[model samples]
Every structure is written in C-alpha cells, then in structure tokens.
Target chain A: MNKRDIALIIIILIIAVLSYCIMNISSDKDGDMVLVTVDGKSYGTYKLHEDREFEIQNEYGYNIISIHDGEVCIKDADCPDKYCVKQGKISKNNESIICLPHKLVIETVRTMDDGGAGDIDSVAK
Target chain B: MSKHVAKLGIFIALAMIFSYIEVLIPFSFGIPGVKLGIANIVVVTGLYILKPQEVFVISVLRILLMGFLFGNMLTLVYSLAGGILSFVVMLVFKKITLFSIIGVSAAGGVFHNFGQILMAAFILHNEKIMYYFPVLLVAGVITGILIGFLSDNIIKALKHYN
Candidate 1:
C-alpha cells in the first residue's frame, strides 16, 4: 500500500463515521407507529404499542411481522436470505427491516401528533 | 487474439470458482449485502494483466453465471448493479495512477456496497435503507483491502509469465 492507498482508506473511514453519526442523530426520537410497505405501496400502519402479529402474503413471497414493546421485527419470512429476520427489532424513528427478495419494508415511523415534524399525515392518504 | 480470448476464458473461470467458494463458506455478518467478495481477487488481478474492457467482461460474466447457478433473479439485479459500479470506479482509479492496486481495489469495494445499497433503496422505495450504509461501508473497505493485498501478490508472482 502506498500513500494514496492510505489516504483512500482514511477518506472512506471518514465518510463512514460521518454517515453513522448522521443516521443516529436523525433517528434519536422513538417511533410510535410501524409502517409496512409492499411493492412500493402501503400495506398497513400499526401502532407500536399494539402488540400484534401481521402476516403478509403476496406475489413475491410471505413474511410475518410482529410488533411488541414499541419495537418491530420480522418474526418469520420465506425469502431466501432471511436478512430481515436477522435484523432483529427496531424502535427508533426511520429504522427498518427490509426483505429485499420480497420487496417488503417494515419501517418505524413517528406519527404527526407525536411531535415528529414534517412527516406525512397517514398511510391511508 | 486467440491467446487473449483463451486468457479471458481462464480468468472468467477463475472468478466463477471464487464465487462458488464464497457461496460454500456460508459467510454472513447478519447484515444484508455484506460479503468477503472473494471473486474480486481475480478482477483486481486482471486490472494489471488485461485490458480494462476484458476485466469488465470477466466481472460481468462471473456475476451472471453465479446468479443463474446459485442465486435468483433479484440477486442477479443487485449483483449486476454492484459489479458494474465497482468495475467503473476501479477502472477510473487505475487510470489515475495515483493509487496502487490496493487503493483501486479499496475504492471498488466501497463503491460496490454503495451501488448495492442505492439499488436497494430504489427498489424498496424508501430511503430508510440508507441506514445500513455506514456498516456496509466499513465492511466494504476491510474486505476490499484484503482482496487488494491478495491481488497485489498475485500480480507480482505473475510478472514472470510476461
């Protein structure tokens, strides 16, 4: 490795640090709702405190989502990778568990009345 | 020309073997889109021995064949995006001549992750996927450096063949 290679490594590390900090800071607020999207469309929005299980079956595949104690996770999935299930649970605003093979996304979102500024009003609209 | 074609075939086969080996290892970091990228060893080595276009072809062919044999359609899309993006970035860095093979490979590694994440965001229609970027970035650099180091030594040993 030469001087330029060292510099390149340093630059990449800096970018990683900056992005991590930004993502953490922006997601400081706890989410109050879980928004599920399938194939770029809204599947459903459930309150985080509800403690429920949601089953999603579609053309792509199947996934079972469970929300409990204000944290959301994919309890089960038929996708090959299972990365979403492995992602564990997310409680912070904007946190997500994505099933890429099924084109499914389960995101933690803050509702408008919950003091999350500038968020869309509802998934229904 | 025939000799070059024959060499390209060998490199492509080498890359595919690397891909197969990677699949056999069951390597996982729990996070999606993170891997050792073992196949990159061949592509990085090709940068010094073959034309940029030839290296690109080998990389593309490797992704396609691996996807068909072991992966699905969705994986094929993700691999194509990451493979193409990294190849372009590596070619540009190599042309600059300021960085060594390790640096070029490192850049390729980081861009490969970035490209895959970007594609994920687009397909999922949510920018929240960007949250995975930082972890993937670090993983990319580390794996890229390892692959680059291996490529550097391979290039050195192959110098005698010229």
Candidate 2:
C-alpha cells in the first residue's frame, strides 16, 4: 500500500462510517410501531403510525417496499435491477420503493406530525 | 478469414452470455448493487486472450449492453465510466501485481464499482452521496474476490483441457 493506497483506505473508512450513520439515523423510530405487511406475510416492522412507517421486502431476489402500510410494495421486480428498491420510499416527502435494475420506483411520500405510520395512506399508483 | 478476428468475436459472445447469466441469480447481499459480477470474468479473460485494443472493445460492449438490456438509458453514462475505469485499473495492476486472472479480475471489479459510485457522486453533487461509497466498496471487494476466484479456476481448467 503506497501513499495513494493509504489515502484511499482512509476515504473508504470515512464512507463506511457515514453510510452506517445515515442508514441508522433514517431507520430511527419515534412513535408507535407499525406492523408492515405484504401479501399477508410479515416482512418487517417499523414504529410510526400511518404516516411515518416504512418496510421493505426481499422476496426471491426482488425487493419490495411498504410505505405507510402493507398496501404497497414494488409492483414489479426481478434480480436484473433493483433500482426501485434503492429508490427507497420516495414519497412527496422523501420515501419510495425502487427497483434498481428494473428501473421502477414509487417516489411518493406522506407528512408526519408524530412520525408514526398511523396516518399513512396507500397510493400504489 | 482471420484467426484473431474469430477469437475476438468468440470472447465478446462469451462475455455477453456471462453477463446475462449473472443478471438472473439473486444475491443475498442486503445492500443494493451486490452481485458476482460474473460478466467481468469475460472481460478479464479477454485481456488474457486478446490484445489490449480487443480487450477494450469487449469491456465497452459488455457494460453497455448490460445496461441497455437491464438498466435505464439514463444510466448509460455511469456504466461507461465504470467499465472504462476498471479496464484502465486492470491494465495498470497487471504491471504491478502480476497476479493470476482471478486477482486481476478482482481488482477490476473493485475499480468498476468505485468508478460508478464516483460518477454518481459527481452527477448528484450531493456530499451525502459519499456515505454510500464505503458500503459499495466493501461489496465491490467481496464481489471482485468471487469473480477472480472463479476465473482462476476457469483458466486452470481451460489450460489443461487445451
């Protein structure tokens, strides 16, 4: 490892720390937990009544997301590209399900006063 | 009409096939953009089998086609950057490390993702984009290792078979 290599290493370390912090911070919860479901299977859970909850699913190599409730996950997906999954929960606020390879995403968001899913609505349009 | 031309054609086809096959399998990596990068194996193989110019051709075609078939056209720029960067890095690393095909392929894979992320950060111009670099790097490392390991065995098997 030369000086260049060393510099690259430091940069990567910083990125890892930053990525961890961002994911953790956004994954935070400050209200009642929401039971996010898809096709009746419990993929994951988040705390935020209707308006503030988010959930994702990795079903058979395809990722799906549920914004406020279980009503929506990625409409279409395959392993080819999960751009939609990466898109995350893009609400008008900043949430959406992205399927990267598939190039599909639901960039729709909802407002939250309590940051809970209790007020979340479903518009899988 | 020409032996070299036939070989180059064969390599291109093989790379495309590998890329398609890799696209089908689902990776367990929770993070997005993680995969075997199997098509990269062909790119590495081309470097070994053909001249540098031919290798470059294969690399560009592989990435461009993969994007066109599986990705949005808007992503073409990122794909081009990644493929070119990896090709260049592999060319340089070849002189320094002189490792086997697998080693070279590994290096190429890491370079590929690093280049892509770099382009993404540039286009987005959001410092926040920097946060994803580390995770992408780590994933790139693991994928590179896998691609390298597989290609190594392939060379070994082919050498003996021939």
Candidate 3:
C-alpha cells in the first residue's frame, strides 16, 4: 500500500469512529415518543413512558410492539427472521427496530415537553 | 468498436452473476441493506479497463437488468442510488489519480452505502434513519476493502493474460 492508500484507510477509520460516537450520543434518551411506520406510511406515535401493547398488521405480516418504563421493543413478529424482536429494547431517539420482511419500522423520536414543540422541531425546521 | 461492446457486456454479465451468488449464499448480517456488495468488483475492474462512458453504461445497465431479473421497484431505487453514487465517486478518484485502485474502490463502497441510506431515509420519511449511517460506514469500509483486494487481483490477472 502506498501513502495515499494508507491515508484513505486512515480517513475511513476516523469517519467510522466519529460516526459511531455520533450515533451513540444522538440516541440519548431525550425523546419520550416512538413512531411506528408501515411501508413508509405513518402508523402512529406513542408515548414511551406509558405501558401498552399493540399489534401492527399489514399484507406482508405483523409486528407486535410493547412499550413500558420508557423503552420500546418488538414483543413478537411473524416475519421469518425475528430480527426485529431480537433488536431488544430502545429508549432513545433514532434507535429503531426494523422488520424488513414486514416493512415495519419502529423508531424512537423525541418530542418536546410542550406537545406543539415536536411539530415545530420536526416540520418548521 | 465491437470488441468494446462485447467486453462491457461480459462485465455486466459477471456483475449479475456475482449478485446472484450473493443472494444464493444468504449472507444477511441482520442489519437491513448490509451485504458484501461483491458485484462492485466488476465496476472497479471496469473503471480501470474501460472508457468512462462505457463504464457508466455498464454500471447503469447492470443495475437495471438486475433489478428487473431479481428485484422489485424498491430494489431498483436502492440499487440505482447506491450504484450511481459509487460509480461517480470511483470516477472522481480515478481522475485524481491519487490513490490505488483499492483505495478508489474502497471509497466507492462507502459512498454506495451513503447513497442507499439517503434514499431509504427519504422513502421511509424518517430522519432517524441517519442512525444507520455509522454502522453502514463501518460495514462499507470492511466490504470495500474485501472487494478492492478482489478487484485488484482480477485486474492484475487480466493484464497478465492480455
């Protein structure tokens, strides 16, 4: 490997490390909401603090979601690989449990303490 | 020249075969959109061997044909985004002539992941999709290096044979 090759490798490594740090820091549990999307459509947004169990059904399959104690996870899924269920619990914004087979994505989103702030933050820039 | 067209066709076919091999192997790493991107070897090799326009044509045709044969509309979008972006980056690096084929290919791999994730974020309408960026970057580097080495060997073999 030449100097350019080594430099490129180093740059990529630095980017990887920086990105990992960014993802971890950004996922901090500042958000109290979870957004469920099915096939690119918004299903609903639920509170993370509230305890509840709900099932999302679509033509592909279904994913059962559970929320309790400020965390969310896939309680169960009919998809061939239970990867979503295995994704475990997520309590932070940007953390998502995705069921690729079902095209279902449950992502943690942060809403401001004032309900209206979420919209402004998300939409109004 | 007819020889040029024939060479491009062969490269496209090889790329398609590589994609099929990946599918047959079931190399799912559990994170959606993560794959070996092994077909990239063909693109890198083509970059080094063919004219710019010829390489572009081969890359676009490969994605379109592969999408039609083995994927759906969504797959078309993902592959187009990734393939085009990676091809562009590879071309730019090739022009700069600052790195080896392996370095250029590695950069192409990372850019490919970025483009795919960007399209996914848009389709899913979720900003949180950015979370996958880091993991994808890491995966990109690993796969890029693997494919780069493979492409380098293939290119060298072809040169020796020629």
True contacts kept of each: 0.87, 0.19, 0.47
Q: For this target, which candidate reaches the highest lDDT against the unseen true structure?
A: 1
Deviation in Å, model 2, residue B103 alpha carbon: 3.9
Give the per-residue Cα lDDT of candidate 3 at A117. Answer: 68
Evaluated on chain B only, what is the TM-score of candidate 2? 0.87
Name the top DockQ candidate.
Answer: 1
Q: Which candidate is the best by TM-score?
A: 1
**Candidates ranked by DockQ, best first?**
1, 3, 2
CAPRI band for model 2: incorrect
Interface DockQ of each model: 0.83, 0.13, 0.50
> Model 3 segments beyond 4 Å from truth?
A38-42, A58-61, A68-70, A75-86, A99-104, A109-125, B28-30
Worst 10 residues of 3 chain B by lDDT: B123-132
For model 2, residues B101-123, the per-residue Cα lDDT tens digits are 55566567777888887776555
Mind giving the per-residue lDDT tens digits that candidate 1 earns over B2-111? Answer: 98889899999999999998888857765566889999999999989888888888999999999999999888988999999999999999998999998999999999
RMSD of each: 1.9, 9.0, 3.3
